[model samples]
Structure formats: C-alpha cells, structure tokens
Target: MSWLPNADIALLKKRAVIIQKMRRFFIQRDLLEVETPSLSQAGVTDQHLFCFKTHFVGPEISERKPDPLGVPLYLQTSPEFHMKRLLSAGSGSIFQIAKAFRNEESGRYHNPEFTLLEWYRVGFDHFQLMDEMEQLLKLVLACDNATRLTYQQAFQLHLDVDPLSASLEQLKVAGASLDLGDVLDNEDDKDTVLQLLFCVAIEPVIANDAPCFVYNFPASQAALARISKDDNRVAERFEVYYKGIELANGFHELSDSKEQRLRFEKDNRLRQKNNLPQMPIDHRFVDSLDSLPDCSGVALGIDRLIMLATGQSHIDNVVSFTIKGA
Candidate 1:
C-alpha cells in the first residue's frame, strides 16, 4: 500500500492543479523560472534556524579519487539565499518551486523536508509585494476575500499588546500573565521575545480564522528585508497564515552589501554566544548585493498551501512521502 492515504489522492491532484496554475500565473506576468544549487558551501547566519548537514567528497579537491576534505554542505532551509544572489546579478523577476530541508524538526506541522515556492519582483516595495501575496493566496485557494493584518494589529487584536513597541519586561509579563508557554532562554533578545509572544499569543488566533498576512515585522527580526524608513523600528516583512499554518514569508529585499554583511556578522556573533558552529559567509552573495536591484520577494510552502486548499489539516496528507514514514 502507498504511504500516503488513498483518500489523499484527490488532495494530491488538487495540489498539482494549484502548482500548475501558479506557474501559469507567473508566466503570464513575464517572470522567469529559475533554479539554484541545493548543496551550498554556506548557510544563513540566522542563529535560530538549523539545517541538515552533509559532506561532499571528490577527487578534484584533494586528488583522493572519491573523497577529499569531506567537504561539508547543508540542505537549504529556503531558496532565499540563492535566489537573492540571482537578483544581485540583474535577473529582473524570478520564481522557483523547490524542495527545502530543516534538521531536528518533526511534527504535525513540520517535516525534515518540504517543498518551497519562492519568487522575486524587481522594482517593487514590500507593500506592493504584500498585494501580490494576497493575489497568490487567492489564486491558490481559487477564492477571494482572504484576510490581511499587520504584525502590530495581529498582536493587538489577539495578544492585546503592540509587538513592535513592547518592552522585553512587558513581553515577559504578558507571557506569564497569559499562561503562555515557557519563555525563550534568551528572552532579552527582543526578536526572540517577540517571536515567543507571537507564537504564544498571536498564533492561536491567527490560526483559528481565515488566512491572514502578518506584516511589518520588527527591524531587529528582519533577516533580509529592508528596514522601514517611516518606523525605523520595523522591517518591511510579512508572513501569511492560514488554518493555523504559516503559508508564506515575503520581504522587501535588502540591497546594501554592507548592511547584509553587518547582519551576517551579527548572526555569527549570535552563533558564538549560543555555542553553535559558525558557517562560512557567502562572499559571492555579498559582492552581488552591491549591484542588487530593489525587489520584493516571497516564499510559500506549496505543501501547506495544498493542505489549506484541500482542507487537509496535517502536512503529511499533502506530501507524497514524509520522512518519518519514509
């Protein structure tokens, strides 16, 4: 018998249909479909996300015939890093649907590996990208009226606090008062604290309703998005939520190489503080950043999108095969 439940075959067909429609949507818009290497020499400097590691062996490097230096590589958690590299090289607008992996994550909502749909729009701001995200969600669901909300508003409506402005102490207090789960060990880090609050307070509410976009994230938490000028306190970033599942993340691309370096260095510092191994910085990416166009980009989980579209609650239902069962 197939690992996937026979009933899910219908859902699988729907997933294929949506994926086909997505390619058509971008094609009609004149966006080029691109591919990037999955086995990369470096990793995202973000200290929180963990990636699965592998070793590359080749005779070319060490003349060992089959193996040399046991070259270390990682399964990409997202195609963002590589896709942005393309943008820096003047690829006007691009999109890709690819497989991504994350280590040490397994749950009803997570698998060690999953499908990712990512795209970039040149000469667009984050808000413009938000509008595009709405269109994409509507297209996938084949329905209109999907909801949208800012991060602050989502928190205020659900957690009763302004996440962007909340003090760490205030966040801790809020967490305790609400019987929210345990605080992150590094709650002093505002980004970490904000994430905790969002998970504890905002997530349940966002998940309970129709799909929504959590927009305008804190600047400190902006991994690769440009910081918002008006607020200086937040970055132009957003994540789409549906049926309690996070479906997509979008950013107004950060084009400054120096800033990107600063962020990468900061992330490395964080890794040292946490005793995690440091990853090599991708200098090629930094070089490209200098010439990178102003763009808005987003990544969607095709499987999760399928889950919502077909009303299948668990991620396993949409996947052809899952790690645990595989």
Candidate 2:
C-alpha cells in the first residue's frame, strides 16, 4: 500500500490496514508498541516449540558453517519470552508485532512462518486479561461475541467428564470411547493424549455462534501460568477461540523464575522422552525475572484473526505468500 518494493500490493494493503487497526486499538488504551531483537544469545526451552536451528557467526569467522564449536542460532517460535522480559524490566504495558517460526508444521491453519501479536499488561490477573481479550476482539472485528467457558466446563459439556480431576485410568477409559481419544492412554504421551482429546473431543464444540474464551487449565499443563488460587488443580490461563478454531492463548504469567525453570525442565524432559531435540534456556530472559512485574500477557495469531474477520478459513488466504508457495 505504501509503495513497498517486495510485498504484494493488495495483500500489503490488507496487512497494513489490519496492523493500523490493531495499533490504534491498543494505542487508545495507552499500550506501547515496541520492537525486539529477532536473534538471541540462547533459544527457547519449551518442548512444544520447535526452533529452526541455524548458525549465525559473523562472516569473519574462520569456520563458515558454525560447525564443531558452532554457536546455535534459531528462529523464534514466539516473541512471548522476550516480551515477558520487557514486562520484568518495568515496561508497564507493551506490545510487539513479530514474525515467528516453527519447524515441521504446515497445514490449513498453520505455516512455517507467521505474525504474532504479543502483548502484556501489568496489574491485571488472568481473568482481567480475559476481559481485555474480549475488548480486543470486539474492537477488531466490531463484534461482541466474547464468550467465556472454563476448560473443565467445556470438557464436561462436550465430552461428559471433568478434565481437571479425571484420573489417568479414567481418562484412558473415557478417551478410548471417543473419536479423538481412541488412540490416547495413560501409558501414552500426556501432551499428545490431551491434544488428541482436545482436537477430537472438546475443541470442535466451542461456541460457533460467537467468539469464546476457554479458561482454567490443568496445573500439570500450566506452561508458564500460575496455579489458580480458587483451585491449585488448575492454572490461570485461557485460549480464545472462534468458529471452533484456536485464535489466541493468554496466561496470568508465572513470575517466579524458579517455577518457570521447573516448567522448562519438565518440558525438556518430555521432549527428550519423545526423542525431540532439547533447546537451550534463555538465561537473559530468566535474569529479567527479578525486575518483571506481576502481569498477564497474550499472543494472538494475526493471520487467524484476519481469516476470521474476513470470513476466510485457511491461513494461507491471509498470508501474502505461504511457505509452500514461497
């Protein structure tokens, strides 16, 4: 739209306008838009995240490929950890529109690369942030379908069980009866099992009549969110959904570096058990924990939001050029 030499005109215009709307929406709330470095001294440790590995030593290096003693560089999965660091550094409220990457994921709803709209707000807990998420969707789409449901409630209403308190034996039994859970078991991978159940059992039944937020996650699955005070059995996190598709994820961010480190360890252990590569910990980000405020943050998929706003279904429709086409 602005005479970009590389980007397509029509797609550029749409992306530009969408970004404009997003920035103005947040700006009205006095949230600061900021930038962050794409590369880091270390990489993400989340087992669910798969970073595209690379070598980034300067050209002056004697070794060209960064082999043998190469310094590992990677494409970021999300700007979340860095943005959280900013929160710790007294950045009261901030947002960043960043390009993120993940390896071996390509589908109608996914790409190897995509835009991530990550933001954080201090002084608000997870539910407060859920309210904020509703505001964002309402403002962005000019719609009021910010419905709320707990994970357990969603599961009970859809799958006829309480996910939080269900035993492994019970889950395996219950899951073996569902289309999504027939392959999952307590003897199998928990993440994969839960994900399979989610895909087949619960996620599809979300409020298609309106936008929805599913909250109160299991504590064992609490990626980086704190355990709920009302119920330590669950975490204070939520995922925003539209038309049965996941659009965003938010958390009452876990502030204790110790707890954060433990989660990272758990994730890596799972990854190792599954034969996935273990990533290095981001120490600088961990160091920022001392200065980080009590806050809640979210990362929303801009491509998916655009798809919903424009009534498109596939992510490639919103992307200017997809990995397959590129």
Which candidate number would show the highest TM-score if scored against the true structure? 1
What is the TM-score of candidate 2?
Answer: 0.90
Q: In candidate 1, residue 166 scores what lDDT?
A: 79
Q: Write the per-residue lDDT of candidate 2 for residues 104-144, one digit (tens) a residue.
A: 88988898999999989899898898888888888777776
Every model's Cα RMSD, please? 2.8, 3.7
Which clashing pairs does model 1 show? 207-244
What lDDT score is found at residue 36 in candidate 1? 92
- State the C-alpha lDDT per candidate: 0.80, 0.79
Model 1: per-residue Cα lDDT over 71-167, one tens digit each: 6677899988888888887788999999998888877778889899999999889778778877877777865556778788887887677777778
Candidate 1 structure lDDT: 0.80
